[model samples]
Target: MRPFPLLLVLLASASLSAADVTPPKGETPPPATDLLGNPTDVPTVSKEEAAVLVVQGKEAMIESNDNPRRSVDAAVAFSKALKYYETTGDTDTICDLEANIFWCKKRMNLDDVKSFVAQKSGDKTVVAALAKVDKVANKEVTADKADEYFSRAEKFASKNPENFEQISVRYFEVAERFVGTEVGIKAQKLSLVAQQNQMKAIKEAQDAQRETLFSKPTKLNGKIQQTAVPSTDTQKSSASSIRTLYKSDFAKRKPNQKQNLLNKLMDQARTTKDDPVMLHALLTAATDLAMECQDFYAVISASDLMAMNFSGVDATAQKKTAFGKSKNPTVLAIIKLLDNPEDGDANTIVGKYFCYEAQKWDLGIPLLMHGTDADMKSLGDMEQLKPDGVAQQIELGDKWYDIGKKGRKGQPTLEGPMGRALYWYQLAEPKITGISKDRIAKRMDEIDSLLPMTNLNYESLTAKQWDRLKGGMAVISAAKDRNDIGLRLTAGKKYRIVPHPTDTWQPTTYYSSGNSRSVNWKGESLTNTPNTRQFIYFTGGDFKEGAMVMQIENGKWMKPGLVEGDGRLWLGPFSDYAWGAGGKGEIRIKILPADDE
Candidate 1:
C-alpha cells in the first residue's frame, strides 16, 4: 500500500502593499490642484516679471522644506517659475526648480515624477532627484514588536507542531509584518518548511490508520482466509509525484526534464481515470514550472492542460467544492504560485502568455508594463530591446488599445483609460521598425483623432494652464480663414513650433524666395534676404513635413498670410524640425518640458 495519502500543501503568505514601493509621502504635501481643482493659464511675462516669479517660487520651496504640507504649493510655484526662467535657459535655476518639483511630487505619492525623470534620461538634476527618492524608499523602517512576533512563532512551532493550520498562520504573520527585511525573508522560508512538515505528518498518520484497519483479517466460509482489499496506492503516488514536480529545481536539470515530467504527469492523471485531484495537480505543477523556467512551450502546454481540466472558475457551491478537492483547489492558488517573488522573470512570462495567448488583458497590462520598464532602464538605451522588450511593448500597446476601446464603448466619461493605449504606442514607436513602425504610426494618428483635445484660450493663459496643455492640449482657429493672430511675447524667448499633422497648408509645394509663386512672392529675395518678409518654415525629419501654418511668439514675424488665416498656431516644444525667421514681427518662445531629446 502507498505509505499514506499524501497531503500536498501550497502556502502563499507574504504580500506587500502597493504604497510601500510607490513614491514618497513626506510629511503631508499640499493639494494637487487649487481648492476648486481648476487650473488657470499662465500669460506671457516680461524679463523683470519672470525674475520676480522665480524669487517668489523659491520662497515657497524654502517654506515647504520645513512644512511638508506646503509641498503642493511649492510644486505649483516652481512649475510657474519654470515657465518664465525656461525662456532664458537658466540652467542653474531650472535644476533647482525641477528638484523641488520632483521632491514635492514624491512626497505627495505621485508616480508622474518618475515618468518625468525617465523622459529626461541623462539630466543630472532630475537623475539626482530620482536617486534621492530611491534612497528614501530603500531606507529601513523600525518594525514594531518584531522580536515579540518571532518569540511567539518559536513557541507555537515547538508546542503545537501538529496544529498545521495555526502554525501556518503564525509564520505568515511574521513574514508579512517584516517583508523586505532580512528577518522577514527568513521567516517566509521557515513558514514554508513548517507547512510542508505538518502536511507530511498528517499524511503518514492517515496511512498508518488505513494499514491497521486493513491488516485485520476476517474469516471466510469453512476455512480461515485473508481478506483481499483494494489499494489506493496509485492515488497516493500521483499526489506525491505532483509535489515532487513542483519542488524540483529546473536550472540544474536536463533540458528534456520538462517534457519528461509533463509526460509522467499526463500518464499518471490518465491512469487514475482523469481524477480531479491528479489532473488539477498536474495543471498547477505545469504552470508553476513553466513560469519558473520562462519556457514558452511549457507555458503553452500548461495553458492547454488548465483549459482541459480546470476549464475555468466554478460558479456554484457544488462545483466549487468538487474543484476544491483537486490539487489546486482554487484558481487563485495557481495564479498566486505562478507570481513568485523570487523569480523576477516569471511576471513577464505570465504577462506575455496572458495577454497574447490567454487574452487576459486585465491581468497582463500591469505585469507586462512593469517588466518592460525594468528591462528598458536596465538595458540603458531607448532603441535597445536586447531580449523581448520591443515585442512585449508592441503587444502591450495593442492590448491597451483594445482595453481603451472597450472602456469608451461602456461609458461617456472622458477618462476612458484610452489614453494609455496611445502612451504605450508612443513608447514602442521609436524602438520598432518596418511594418510595425508603419502600423504604429498609423494607429497613433487614428487614436489621436479619437481623443479629445482641450483648446485653451491661447490668447491669454496663466502658467498653470500652460503647463496643463503641454502634453495633450490643442488650440483651434475660430476664424473661417487663417489670420495673423498668435501668442504675442517679448524678444529672446525661444519656442519650437509644431504644426498639426493634418493641418491645411496654403502652398502644396516647398517654398523659398526662388520658388514662392504660390504665395505671389516669386522672384523676391525671401531666402537669406534682409528685405524679404520673415517666415516660419517647416520641412523634413520624422513625423509630417510641411510648412502648414505660421505662428507668432516672443515677437517673431512670419511672411504675410502663409496659412489660411486660422488665427491660432498649433505648436509643441522639442519638435524634430522647424526654423523661425528672426526679426520683423518676431515672436520669442520657450520649449516646455525642456525637450526630452
Candidate 2:
C-alpha cells in the first residue's frame, strides 16, 4: 500500500543513477524513447535499500513464489530471496542471492548467481548474506526479549570479531533470551536454521534465474544519441532547458484541459475544509496523479485541481522534481502561463490560485530583485525605513530570493525543505507581473524557437489516445510523428484504452500484491502484500543515472548547451541510425503507479 510522503516503509532496489547510465553508443531504438528520454530515472537505491531484502522469514524479490521458473524473474523478485543462507545473515549487506541473480540477469542471468553462490561457503561475502536474511524473516521478537538478546549479543560479538560461528551462536542466544532461553532457542536456532536450510534446497535457483532473467540496456533504437554531460554550470537557465535530459517538447500539448482540471480541484478544497492531516495526505496523493506534466500548468494546478477526484491523479507534474525544468513540468507550464501575466481573477478560483501564489512568491521576489531604494517609497520606489525593518527586509528578501533563485536554477544543491518551500512560495504572488512585455514576448519566442530543433510536438494528446490499460497491454500510444514515434507523448492522450502488450523487451513491470506470487497472472506472488489496495507494478525503462542536461541558470548555463542546438536530433527518431544509439534489447524499467507516485 502507498504511504504518506517520504514515508514509504519498504526498500526499493532502486536502479543506479541514470547519470552515468546512458544509451549504449551503438544500439538501435525500440518502441520507446532512448534511456535518456524515458522519464523513468531509477530512484536512487541507497544502502537503505538492503533493509527491504530481509522481510519476514522469506526472501523478497520482484517475482512471485509460484513461478517454477522463478529464476527468470528472480532479479526483480524480492531482494530477500538471495539471502537464503546464514553466510549473509545479520550482515546488513546487498549481497542477497537474489540480488546477485538480478545483477547476473542484467549481465548474464541466474546462471551467474548460482555459480557465484557455489563458491566456498566460508567466503566472507556468502556468510554475511545468510545472517542478514535470518533477522528479517523473524517476526516474533518482542521488545523486552529483543533488549535482553541485544545486550548479550553485543557483549559476545564485541569480544569475538573473528569468531563468526561464535558470534552467530551468540546472536541467536541473545535473540532467544527474550522469550526465555528455551523458546528463543527454538525460534532462533531451530526455526531459523531450518529456514536457512530450506532456502539452500533450491541450489539451482540462482543459475536458472540468470538464464531466464536478463536485463536489457536502455539504448536508443537507431537514433543519433550523441550523449554529453553538463560539463559545468552556466549563468542562465529556464524550465525547458532544465529538464532537457529527456528530450521532450512540451509546447504542443493541449492547454485548456489543464486549466479546467486545476479549476476543479480548487473548488473541492474550499467546499470541504477537511481534516488537515488526512487532507494533506489526500492532497499529496491527488497531486501525484497529475504528474504527467508537459510544462508549468501541471505543477501548480495539481495542488488545487484534484480535491474532487478519488480516482487519484495519473499525469500531473512532480513538485519534488519541480524547480527549474526537467522533472518539473510546472515551471515550464508556469512560464507558459506567465506569457500574458497581468490581471489575475479577483473572484474565480484560477485567478485566486495564482493570485495567492503571486502574493506569496511575489512577496519575496520583488523585495529581493527590486531592492530597497528606501522604505519611504514602499517598493513603488520606496522611502527610508527603520534599521530593524531594513535588517528584517534584508533577511526576508534573502529568504525569498534564495527560493526564487532555486526555482530559476531548476535544481538547487542547497539543503532544507524551507528552501524548497520558499522556492515555490516566492512564485505564489508576483505571478510574473514584473516580467515586462518585452521579456514575456522574448521568452515565448525563445521557448518556441527550440521546438523545431527538437522536432517534437508540444500539444497535449487527448485521453482517447493514451489509454493506460493494465496487463500485457502497454500504452501503444503513438507519438506526434514517426521520428518521434516514442519520443514525445503529449501530456493528454487522444485515444481510448486499447490493449497493447505492456511486456516489451524495453523496461516492463508487473503490478501485483501479496508476494507477487499470489496475484500475478504469471503465477508468482510477492510474500508481504500490503493489506491496502496498492499498485505493485514495474515497467521496462532504461536504468541509467547521474546524466546531465544542457541548461542555462541565472543568466549562465548550469550545464553547457552542447546538446541545446544538437542539430542532428531534429532529423527524427533514434531508429534513424543517424547517431550512435539505436539498438535492440536495450531498455530498462519505467514504473508508473497504478495511479501515479
Candidate 3:
C-alpha cells in the first residue's frame, strides 16, 4: 500500500462557512472568476441568500448519508452556494463548495443505503453497463494471424541461435503486438530465455578472461611467477582453516576461555583483508560465540561487520558456502532466516538469539513479534512493558499503528513496522467490546489494506512491453486527442490498469492553492468514508471518485477491468464535478492485456 499524504487528508475534510466567503471590512473584493483566476459570469446574491443556501447545502449533505436520494438536493444547494461565493470572489469557499459538490454526487451512487438497495433489488443499469463492457472485452484476436507472426519470430530465433540479443528483440516485438494470445505468451517466455542466455554468455566470457589472466605467467621483481586463481575448493579450504584457528566447544570451555577465543576472532577480523571467505568464517564464529556468551554488542558488531563486507553479495549463497551443509541449530536458523525471514520458527530462534542470548532488544523485538513461539512473544511483550487493561492495550495498539504509519528508520525488516502494529492490534481485538471493538476492527482493516500483499504477480510480458507498462502513456486533461489512446478495446478482453508513479493532477486548480499540491491517479476523498467504492450513477461508476477514470468510445466511464464491449479507449482523471474543466497536470496510465482473460 502507498502512503497517504496527511495534508491532502486535512484538505479533503476541512469545512468552510459563509464568513469565509465574506470580504474583510473596508476591503474591495476581486472580480468574479473561477479558482484558477479564469473569468466567469457569476451573478451576485444577497448575503442573506448566500447564508441560507450554505445552511441548506450543509443540512442536505448531512442527511444524504442516510437517504442517498438527498444527494441530488445537496448537490444543487452546494452548486448555488458556490455561485454565491464565486460572485464574492472568495476562492477558499468556492474551492470548498466545489469539493462538497463532488462528494454529494459521489454519495448519490456510493452511499451505503443506495448500495444496499442496489445489491438487494439488482440494478438494471449496472447489469447493462457490465454487459456492455464484457461484450467489448470478450472480442477474440485473429488466432491465425497471431500464430503466423509468432512463427516468423520463432524461425528467426532458430536461424540465428547464437544471436541471443537479436532473437530476444524479435520475440519481444511479436509478444507486444499480439499480447493476450497463446502465441504471444510463448513469444514472451522465449524472449526471457534469450535474454537469460545472453547474460550467461556475457558472464562466461568474463570468467574465461579472468581464468586466462590468473593462469598466465608474469614477471615480478625480475622473476616469473604464476598466480593461482581462487577456486571453490580453495575458498572452502581457507574458510575451514580459519574456523579451525578460532572454533572452540563452548560447552567444554570455561568463561575465560570463551572470552579469549572471542577476542582472538575479533582481532582476526580486524586484521583480515583480501580474503572474503576467511573474513566470513571469522565473523560467523564471532556471532555464534557472542550469542552463546549473551554478548549483545559483540553480536551486533559481528553482524554489522559481516553485512558491510558482503554488501550486494548473494547472502544465501555466501552463507551456504561458508557453512556448507551444517546441521547445527544456530547455523540452520541463520540460513533459514536469510532465505526466508518470515518463517515463524526461524524467526523465533533468531529472536531468541538476539533478545535472550544476545540481549539486543532493538534487533530482537521485530523478530519476536513476528515469531509464533509463546515464550518469545511473552518476552517481547515484557520488553515492550505490555499493559493489562483493555483501554491501555488499545492505546498501545494505536501507538504502534501511528509509528508504523510514520514508518521506521534503519534497515527494513520482513514483517515491517506495520506488521508490528498489527501484532498489538490482534492482541487487543478479543479483549475489547462494542464501539471499541469496532474501532479496532476498522483500524485492523486499514492496516491490512496498507500492508503489502505477497505473491501478487502481473501478466508476463517481454522486456519492451514491461518498459511500456512502467513508462505509461500520458492522459492530459479531458480533451479527446489528449485522452484518447487510439486503440480499441474488445468486450471480453481483460486489461491491467496501473497509475504511473509520477503522474499526478489536481481535479481543480483551487486545491493547489498556488503550489504543486497535485494528487496521484487515485484522487483524494473529501469524506470520512473510504474512497474505494464505485460511483455507478456516473459515467465512470466502475471506479472510485478521484481515481483515473476511462471511457469506451465516449460511452460509460469505467476503470481497469474486463472490457464490457468493443470501443476506442479514452483515459483521464475523474473530474465530473468540474465538468472536466479547470484541472492542472496529467494522468499517465499503462494498459496491458491480462493473461487470465
Would you give me the overall lDDT of model 1? 0.41
Candidate 3, residue 345: CA error in Å?
Answer: 20
lDDT of 3: 0.52
Query: Which of 1 and 3 is the better model by lDDT?
Result: 3
TM-scores, one per candidate: 0.19, 0.22, 0.26
Give the number of the best model, judged by TM-score: 3
Superposed Cα deviation of residue 576, candidate 2 (Å) = 23
Q: Is candidate 1 or candidate 2 better by lDDT?
A: 1
Q: How many pairs of residues in model 2 come into backbone collision?
A: 177
lDDT of 1 by residue, 1-597 (tens): 112111222224222222333335663222232322212232334554455445544444334433343444445445555555666777655544554444444444333344443454533433332333333223344697666666777676788777554455466556655777776787777777766776687667644332211122322223222122213675467656667665653333654465456555555544443256566566556545544444433444444434444434221332223233334222333243233422334444544444444334444444444353464223222212212245666665675566566544323222233444555654455457668879887777666666544322232222233343453333422222233334433443333432222222223223331222222111111222211122223323422222223444322334222222223443321112343121121122223321111
Residue lDDT tens for model 2, 14-89? 3222111222356321123223221221122222233333232122121222222232223332332332232335
Give the per-residue lDDT digits (tens) of candidate 3, residues 449-509.
6554321222221122234443245455633222766667676665666555444565641
Q: What does the lDDT read for residue 84 in candidate 3?
A: 58
